[model samples]
Target chain A: MLRGFLVLVLFFLLGEALQKVFLIPVSGGVLGMMLMTLTLMFKGGISDDLASASQGLISVLVLLIMPGVVGVFFTADQFAGQWLAVAAALLGGTFLSVLSTLWLMSRVVRLGGGKGE
Target chain B: MARVNDWYSRLLSLPETLSASPALAIGLTFGAFFAGNAVFRRIGRPLWLPPVVLSAVLLAAVVALLGMDYKAYQQGAHWLTVLLGPATVALGIPLYQQMHHIRALWRPILVTLPIAATLAAVYALVIAWSLGATPEVLASLAPKSVTAPIAIGITQQLGGSVPLMMGGLLITGVVATLFVDLAARWLAISDDRILGFALGLNGHAVGTARAFEISPTAGAFASLGMGLTGVFTALILPLVFHL
Candidate 1:
């Protein structure tokens, strides 16, 4: 588990390094994910240890954002006057996005001869 | 009277310990999340009681009650904050695991995921702008459909408010998780692939979790959607918006 975790950390650091070197706008974590995905694809698969370590970390992924969420909560007063606008935009935008994506994907899959179960 | 004064002094000093030590903050985070998870389980895992949201609320209440400010809480919670990047990198494992399934539908996924993500971003932007939202709020809402870590990056690059971005993400996740099933039923969308993709696209991690509860194939496709959407948004949004 320790080795596996170290590998993940190394990938993350590599991602950060790449981001700095390339002046990319993307986050290091995301670039790390892309790197790991490519590694897994080329390497055939992950070792059991690596797999377990990743699983352990991913399982509590939501917990990692608690601090940020709490930060938002404390500063929520900044948006107090605009709650209505924010709500309308988020609700309308998300609902429409989901609906449109679902509609378009189903159509594309059908046209591609993929069976939809 | 002397005993009451002593208790008051101790209470005042509590923040010094809890809000100054990384270990204590980490412990508090885990303890709060554990309690949230327990409550979620006890409530039969309702859609509204997401463990993250519940834990954040619980933690925030505790912080408020203790008179500890956000900065102090953040200082002590730096350990967990640092792990966010690694945890996001860890998401690659599940995405890698689903590579076979993704490969089979690569064409559709490749074509659809980017469009879906762009559509989501544009929808939020246009709607928020039309609703008279500030540019800051619009920027924050633009990345609301993506996962939190990537969303935060996008928001920062776009000069949006991170707090607003986090709030937008939480709202999107909860709404998608709660409404996807009902909306699907209303729209008569019984196709697992479509349902899964929609969940993943708009809901991110939380939506993907809901997809898993439906079926393994749904879960796999949901992971694909989530991963592809994250990549697409991170790579494209900055360039498209000139951020």
Candidate 2:
């Protein structure tokens, strides 16, 4: 598990360095993810240690992100004048997003002659 | 005699020293999270009260009660936050595992990802624009559906406030988690792959977490959706704005 963490951190750091040198728009973690995916594809399998370490981290993803969510409370001024706009956009955008994807996928599945269910 | 006195004084100041240390913040977070988890389990884990949300709300309340600034709390919590980088990279495992599913539906996924992602961003921007949001706010909202790290990067690339982007991401996630299920039931679309993909695309990591609760297939698809959406949007949005 420790070795797995070492691999993940090394990939992440490399991704971060790449982003810095190349001005990549994506986050280091994301670039690292892509890089790791490619590497795993090349290697053709995940090691048990890496799998366990990664799963351990993934399992508590919420805890890792919670501090940021809590950080939102302190930034009240940023949304002071436009809470309604933010609220509407979030609600409408999310609902529409889900609906559109669902609608599109089901329509495509039906056309492709697959049982979508 | 002097050494004993020194030890006694140190013991007396232990509470203050502990509070000043990083462990306090870390302990507070995990303590709140486990407590929230306990409460969630006790209450039967309703869709509306995810442990993360409950924990965040509770943690915020506790911080406010202690008159602690978010920065001070974050000083210690940053240790955990740094793990997000590795954790996100680790997501590759699940995404790679789902390669066959992705390969099978490559056509539809390829077709749907860009369109769904574009629609998600545009709808939020248009609605917020119609509702009188400032340009910066709109910029921040543009990446609301993407994962937080990538969303932060995209928001920065677009000249948006990190705080607003984070806020939008969190709320969008919570809203998506609650409503997507309702939308699925309403649309009568029961394919975990499709449903999970939507959840990941619109909800980002929070949605992805919820998707895992549904099933491993859903989890895998959701990870795929999130990674692809992140890559696509990260590559495209900045260029669009640059133009």
Candidate 3:
């Protein structure tokens, strides 16, 4: 637990340093994550300090789904009226995304000197 | 303060408005999207009916109509973002579980990681350029498809003047979910492993979830792709942008 808190705090602070001083574009939270990842890599396996600290927090990641869930509170009425546009964007984006990326992915694999067949 | 919040809340909750809670609103929109998806699927329609995209679009529409600031919506969303830490940490657990396979795949992963990362960014830039998007947006969108917090970091550094790369992440997730299977099939990639990883690499969480639906092995690879992509993007994007 101590390790987790310390690491999280440490990473965030360092991230802030990079953000403020160096003006690195990534979020501090991410920098913190990367810092922690590096710590684990160097140390080779989780310490009791690291595991206990990180485990509890990692469990409820799903709760982050709330705010977006909450965004729906105001959108209830608009559902019926603009459902078409919403549907179109959703479907259209999905279609384009799937077709384009799939095609590109195959070409990429082949270009990389690999063949699925 | 509570009273002030309550008064403003009441004003916002007028029948002329939508739901008062962003969380509830989000939950309900997804609920409706599921229903919509059910309707489409029942009729044997295309799988292009995306629940997340549909739900988010529906939410954005109401925000536009009600003149609700993104701030108010995010007030409710702050709860969600706080969970990001735990979510990322959980990634460790799954990663540990798959350690053996990870060891075996390490070589290929190293070689492929940079290539995949570069392609995702380049494609994003290409699309924005084709669409004639503004420079700020192009810059902001470039590092998207990496991961949320990291994307946010890069966006902040670039002075992109936009919300973190999260919005773009969300879009990528929804898109990845819808198309992962199609891509896998199109490539004639017989292995589910490759399909899942590609989707997750390109899509992130949504793709990861889709990978889970396919099988555990695929899900595992997807997770790897997601994690590796974030790390690679962080290290390499700055170098690429500099060049």
Candidate 4:
């Protein structure tokens, strides 16, 4: 577990460094995820340590994000007078995006003869 | 009489003293989370009442009652948020697990990613624009479909407010989760991969969580969708704005 955590953190730090050095638009964590994915692909498998550690962290992901969500209290002012618009954008956009993605993917599977089905 | 007065004074000052302690913030967040999780389970885990949402609401109320400032709460809570970086990187595990799926459908996955992710952002931006949302709000909303850590980064890059981005992210997750489930049923689509991918692309982490509940295959696809979408949006959105 410790080894897994160490690997993840090292990859994350490396990702951050790459982002800073290369001016990557994606966040370091995301870049790290990509790099790690590539590394795993090349290695052809996952380590037991990495798998368990990653699962442990991913399992509590919601708790990690809760602090940021609480920032809603701070942004209450931003929502003032635009609540309806914000609400519509979030609700309408999410519904539409889900529907579109579902429809498009289903069709892609059919047309391309993809294995997703 | 003096003793009673002294005891009352100590009691009155207790909250202030506790609020000053960073541990109080950390403890409150975890305590609330577990309590929220317990309640969510007890209530049969309603789709709308995710433990995180419940925890956030409960924490907000508790902080208000304690008269604790958000900044003060953040002193301890920030440590937890820091873990999000590692967590985001750890997504590689699940993505790697789906390597077989990727090998089989890389082309379809690639084709679907750009359109789905772009639409996710564009639809929100268009709706918000039509309704007169400010540019900053639009910037924040643009990355709403990605995971929180990635979305936060995109918001900063765009000079949008992180707090506003977070609000949009949370709501988008909840809305996408509910709608995808309903849409899947209404459309008679039972493929877990498609369901999970849509959930991840549109809903992100929250949707990914729900997808996992359906099945591991769904969970893996959700992870793939979320990771790819985050990378794609983070790479593309800023370039589009620069143009």
Name the top TM-score candidate: 4
Q: For model 1, how does the per-residue alpha-carbon lDDT over B129-149 read when each residue is reduced to its tens digit?
A: 877888778778888888887
Q: What is the full ranking by TM-score, best candidate first?
A: 4, 1, 2, 3
Best by DockQ: 4
| DockQ of prediction 3 | 0.17
**Best to worst by DockQ, what's the order?**
4, 2, 1, 3
DockQ (0 to 1) for model 1: 0.67
lDDT of 4 by residue, A1-117 (tens): 999999999999999999899988788998899899999989988889999999999888888898899889766986688888889999999899999999888888878758644
Best-fitting candidate, scored by lDDT:
4
Q: Give the Å error, residue A19, model 3.
A: 9.7
TM-score of 1: 0.92
Candidate scoring better on lDDT of 2 and 3? 2
Compared with the true structure, what per-residue lDDT tens digits does model 3 show for residues B25-67?
Answer: 4554345456545564666755454444554555566556667
What residue runs in model 4 are displaced by over 4 Å at the alpha carbon? Answer: B1-7, B19-21
Clashing pairs in 1: none
CAPRI-style docking class of model 4 based on DockQ: medium
Instruction: Give candidate 1 misplaced runs (Cα > 4 Å).
Output: A113-117, B1-7
lDDT (Cα, 0-100) at B34 in candidate 3? 62
The interface RMSD value for candidate 4 stands at 1.1
Ten-residue segment with the worst summed lDDT in candidate 3 chain B? B159-168
- lDDT, candidate 4, residue A86? 87
Give the per-residue lDDT digits (tens) of candidate 2, residues B88-182. Answer: 99999988887777677767787789999888888888899999998888888999989887887888878988877887888888888888899
**Against the unseen true structure, what C-alpha lDDT does each candidate score?**
0.80, 0.86, 0.59, 0.88
Docking class for model 1 is medium
